[model samples]
Target: MAGTLGIGIITYNRKDTLRGVVDSILRHTSTDFEFVVADDGSTDGTPDLLRQLNVPCITGRNKGISWNRNRILWYLKEEKRCDWIIILEDDCFPTVFGWERPWIDAIERYGHVNFMPELTIEIDNDISSGRGTPEDPFIAPMHQAFCIGYHAKALSYVGYLDTRFEKYGEEHVEHTQRFLRAGYGGLSQHLSPERGQLFYLRGGLDTLPSHSHGSHELAMRNKTIHDAIRHEPLYRHPWRNDEEMFEFREEIARVLPGPAPEPEGEPQLFDSIISLGGDELVNQAIRNHFGRPGPGLFDQFIAPFHTLVSLFRHDFSGLLSTNCLYGYHDALRCRDTLLIYHNCLEKQPGEHASVEMFHAQLPLLRHRFHTMIQEIDSLCHRSRRVLFVRSWRDGFLYAGQHRPAHVASVDFQALVDALAARYPSLDFRVMFVNFGKAHATDSRMMFANTDTPDTCPRDEELAGWSRLFSTYRIGLHT
Candidate 1:
């Protein structure tokens, strides 16, 4: 007769590990359970090996471990070959005595409830505090283990392994928690007589090291997923539909492969970019610092900037530009990082001139700017930096003109000079873009400024402004 329980294992490219686990299972158990391995696209020789084994194995399209497991789960349920499903990881193996009698006996006794074999981290034990220590007890929650039974009804109710937790961190805990929350009791048995073996090359607590150290990371992820599920329309289950979970796991794997290189110990020089109002200079600056395009020259040139913006607006990749903020919403949203604004005013006669002619505008502008500054200051206390970008006409001297002297208040040079003096201890930079004319207009808008003198000099100052503006934009983007 066919076995009552369906044994399942998840594997990737590790052929040696898989061999060990399967070998242990064969040697230990007397019952004839159908062993199922959902191989996640193993390019290594594992597929051939699985075919050679006398067990039921399913090769899954390797989207990732989570995706592979979930995808094949439907197949397992439809087959209806067993009453309970026991899940294990390729890295873990069951021992002889511990495997045959203790594990199977425990399952036979507590078949209705979920069963988890005693897991042990068997890598190194020379250090006493390592595995078997008081902190690292043998009894614990189910991990990627040798035996975890899932009733057919339970699998149907809970669905499948969440593909969101793509790699390893918390998918198991997520499953276990859900099982418990659903009112299912789980049991663990110290397999006796040692007929089978479930061993791992690395990872487990000391002597009896069994439990994973630190609280399960999935708990935090679970909370986040729960919250997103509640609020975000796209999220299915607050607990499982996780794209971030995969990111978090792979990140840990990447760090573990090599000794973590200390974060490029705080670079010597950094930038504080204060963007003034509308200009293409900011975009130009980013391209310079981060490097240029590859062979596909035409596509690079033609793709609309907005298209790229939309691509990056979601969490597909890291920020392309120095974290940018344009309008009021952006300003408020980014109150934590850098706050940018278009504070430059259009040319006005004496009445509309800056605070010099109209001292009244000074307080208003100061109040607005000051509030932003205060907000930034508060964030600074919480450990965030602030940058403000301002731009103005180069030659529009208000000394003799009725133009409010305060209009020049946004002058790049004056502001930089004063800020340097006032906040000598704080890091800051001011950039000047000397338009051919002394107006706050963009380069394209320069022609519209009627106040521009008919015979403006070749404006050598334009070079300084251009250089400074380019540098500022570059700094902000980085």
Candidate 2:
């Protein structure tokens, strides 16, 4: 009888890494699963060494990562006919608990589906490695193993990874997004950082980063492929409705995929920002407020606040760099948390839309607001809208009691001014706060009282946003 699962690993010239990945998988996973090793014309002794291993493998010409993966998909159809195929990278390894029956059980429960195994990055010594661990092994948007997926229909639908990426990045996310667009539900494993650490020893990267040397060629190829994808529009799931598109976009983020699984026993730290409403509205407001609809207030005022807060709360650096991470962390935590928030107003907004934007960008505004619930992982909870209100005199009230290190109530603009004034050399920046129609406004001189809406027509509206922001760790304007 044939095994139910097969593994497809894509490799280039990294022979040692490939060997380690293969050895690790065979050792950890006892289930009779076929392993498909697809090579992209690795000039290094990778081709010869594969013959020595005597494992079921596939060899192909020097195409991109996406094409290499497609070639393996071809093998699965023509030769293996596997019930399911697990896709992996040569540098990644599988943990002893990686082949747990629960994972297979999850596949059986939600089978023939494209799933993103849980992903965790292990920084062993200076070398960072990503492998599946027992605790938090679920589907995600990074370099991860695709599991519980059959060899036939999925291949036809996804058509292998996008050949745009000659070596690394973009392929996994694009593939997963395509599956989701096709109305296929995928299972994401729920494992922890601790679980992810088991397979990787701490060490710096020993091999040459794939695209570093040939960046110019890779960039040109990526541009060509991306242009093609634009016209062709790769995602075509049956469930391509507006809501699904928004949701799929958000869930499809490359940065910290999904909410950080609540640490096993700890109380959750960051709250949901979805209750605040869509950033599109804020972008629109900025467009209307300013003459030019370029990347202005929304980029300056709104994006920074969200990005900075997100940096502290989660490692979801979808499009941000390590330098940015270090800078953000240093700014926020170096002194008192409140002080950091107080001082950060002078920073510039991150202008580019990165992995975070790709995942969070809802094609439509209303749908975008609805999809944010997934980011917080509080989809099941009561929703609230967040608003920041302030008066020149009530600055002390906004300061509040001993503030949580992670959040502040004052207007972000004020924080920037304070920081800029204190540090003459630093450039203070306005926090990016998308103000959609949700922002409560009143013609009357007095502020609206939300509790008694009839007496204060604007009160309910203002209170609605206040409640929303508060739930999401945002503070109310005094």
| Residues 1-478, model 2: lDDT tens digits | 2346667777888887788877777777767776678777688988788779876545544656666676566555535576566566665556654453444433334333333322223331222333232233333333333332443555556554655466644554456545545434343322421112111111111222333224666666665655456335543341224443232222112111112221244322221122111223333322332222322212211133334344324432321221232123323212222212112133346543332332343244224323432333332233232122221111111221111122343344333343234333432122222121111122111121111111122344345334433333322212
The global C-alpha lDDT for each of the candidates, from Candidate 1 onward, is 0.39, 0.39
How big is the positional error of residue 404 in model 2, measured in Å on the Cα after superposition?
Answer: 68
Q: How close is candidate 1 to the true structure, as a TM-score?
A: 0.35
User: Residues 1-478, candidate 1, lDDT per residue (tens digit)?
Assistant: 1246566777788777777778777776566666667677678978789768755556533555455555334445545356556566676655543243333333343332332333233332222222322223223342443345555565555555565554545554455444444433233222421111111122221111233322556557654654343222221221252333332222212211222212334332323333332232332332343342111111111112232223223321221122432234211112223222222323344323222322334355445544544543443333223343332321122111111112332333444444444444555433233222234332211111112122233242233344443433333324
Q: Model 1, stretches more than 4 Å misplaced?
A: 1-3, 71-73, 97-147, 186-478
For model 2, the stretches where C-alpha displacement exceeds 4 angstroms are 1-3, 97-103, 106-151, 163-169, 185-224, 231-478
TM-score of model 2 (CA atoms): 0.37
Lowest summed lDDT over 10 consecutive residues: which window, candidate 1?
Answer: 293-302
What is residue 391's positional error in candidate 2, in angstroms? 89
Model 1 lDDT, residue 145, Cα: 36
TM-score of each model, paired residue for residue: 0.35, 0.37
